[model samples]
Target: MTKRSAGTTASPRPGRRRLVIGAAVLAAVLLLFWQRDRLSPRRAPSEDDLLAASPAQSAGSAPGRDQAGPKPRWVGSKNAGTGEDAEASARQIAEKRLERARHTLEGYVQATRYPPGARPLSEKPDLQKPHSVAKNTLPLARPDHKLTDARVTLEQDRLYLVGDEAARLVASCTTSDGPARCEVLRAEARVPETMPQASTMPPARVAFADEGAGGSTIAALFAPAKEGFGGYHGPIAINLDLRIEGEEGAAQFNVVYTPAPPARLTGDVREVIENGSLCLYLRLAVDKPGRYVVVGRVDDAEGDGFAYLEHNDPLGAGAQEAKMCIFGKLVLDERAKSPFVLRDVEAYLLKEDTYPDRELVPGRDGPFHTTKAYPESVFSDAEWQSEERDRHIKEFTKDVKEAEGELEALP
Candidate 1:
């Protein structure tokens, strides 16, 4: 009967039970302390940081898989070259955008000059009837700087603009091994205060082939007007950038410049007559004083996937009409038009005086997917075409209404 009470601890000789429990708790705390140094941090990442760290995440690839990084909402995938590489997707969205931009620029180029006759060139067999240069108060020629079939040097994994024509202008590029990585080449043309007094007169009668000598994409940047040339001379500068992408090999481009008032513009009419181009007369007022750069560019894109077209032209008499084939070839359509026409062009200014090195977009040679520069001023498309004015007005009204609705909804 003197055996320890049923509920009492046999070892509790005065508070021994409480001391045993305390020692057990101490052992547990020591165990936890030994492992506390192995934890990680937790916080949300900024969007840019997330993108900078994992460029391919949005492309549906596991992070770190894509070198072009994430595709920006503004860009679209397109193919703008020929040969085996033509089948490859352009890492830069500029490839696709350039196509759209060319349509617009084609309009300008056409407008700048006249096709050989009033009728379409394809319908006219006497393509050389009254041979003449396309008209442009402000004319542009393939610069002395020329480029060749863009050669992707497999050995170096870089691209070179070579060939007899490539020797004209100075340019350079750097390449990489990745598919999206493009060896971007850049060339600069300093716009003279006046058209350089050329030893060679303008081509007597300029002719543009559906397939021209220049490769898929090309750009021309005009500098501030220099001294000498009258009427055509002024503070105006144009930086035209263009390219063509997609399965269509045909390149189209256009640009419209309204002469500042006090500076009148006139055209030879015959110049544009040969090209079936359009012309516009603009009266500009120099409310602002500055030099402007008006730019134009083009790209001959070969469509891919669903964009590929196939057909052949019909031969005469007993000859069978060739099935029109557009496989990776550009086809000219009447519908393509210009994308942008900037006025009051000024020197490019940024938060940083120097141009920042942008990340090369996937399938591109540089971070910027497109080479087209933005308008330096708050100008509108309406300034280019009266048709665009109405749309611009509607857009403004919609914006005002949306802002009002948002204001009303706010607490």
Candidate 2:
């Protein structure tokens, strides 16, 4: 080393100085990386790392883990979001179905209470006689000869049958004299040209005698139409009268008149035979139980013939109003011989009766009992049941409310 001056420094090794500088630089770089690693976000672990750290995955490798089967795949957050969406959709569908069921129940309740059709009559008819025409004509003979000799005559608008020829006609000719003799007898009883033809005759006016005190009467007038009646050749302007008489205090009465035959019928009235005869059935309820009478005259449309029926029978009473069914049947004469048939039959509650206890024959079965079956009105058993209808409406309403609450809690 040479003697150095006070202001001059000795020369150092180039390699050593360079190495020191490099080492300093390298240390600064390492320190900077360490600081970054601490402050910056760490790299997230791979799926494999996460699975290895999980308890379920670790349990799969542990004893008895195989018996439980491999751990179910971990559901990701995206899958969890999908599950929540599916649950929300299902709840909405269930809520809509319940709402519809509730509305249907409400509709059923209204229809059952107020049925669609004619309502019961609220007021009674005025007990005055209807305007009508009267005629007196002789009865015609039946077409077939085997029948008995018969004659029909009108007196004061009342039609009467003087002979039983119609009975003989229906029954087989039973005579020891011989079939030829029966035929001769039948021919001799033929309808004469001089006699008044029923077809050409005008309509008749009729009146009935009023019963004693507290008695009620009703008269129904019918205007003849051309339809329904068969083979009728005469003018269509015929009028028919139906009369009813009731005992004292007979306040409640219901009459349903159907021009066309009923589609469905039930009860005792259904047993009656409707062949060839015009039929009428009645439903009567009395506040005061007693005897009642229904009288009317029926004519053939073709003016071939007519018949009359008088129903006199006692009606009974109990805790409720006395109920009775009266059926009227008018047999047509020689229905096939003439095209004239019965049509446009109508009924009227002419008279109402109060409670009167009278000993009378019960109406016999045949064309005289309630013949046509029809459903009763609101109070009648034939209508819809009220109690059952209310029950269904209440039940459906409860279900809808419960579903709504469940949906609200879902989210």
Which candidate leads the pack in TM-score?
A: 2
Q: Model 1, 401: alpha-carbon shift in Å?
A: 57
The CA lDDT at 86 in model 2 is 56
For model 2, residues 254-344, the per-residue Cα lDDT tens digits are 1111222211112122232222222344344343455455433323334432333334555454322122221111121122122222222
Clash count, predicted structure 2: 31
* Model 1 agreement with the true structure over 293-343: per-residue lDDT tens digits: 111112222211111111112113221211111111111232222321212
* Per-candidate RMSD, Å: 27.2, 34.4
Best by lDDT: 2
lDDT of each: 0.24, 0.30
Residue 21, candidate 2: C-alpha displacement in angstroms: 68
lDDT score, residue 101, model 1?
33
Error of 1 at 165 (Å): 40
TM-score, cand. 2 vs. native: 0.20
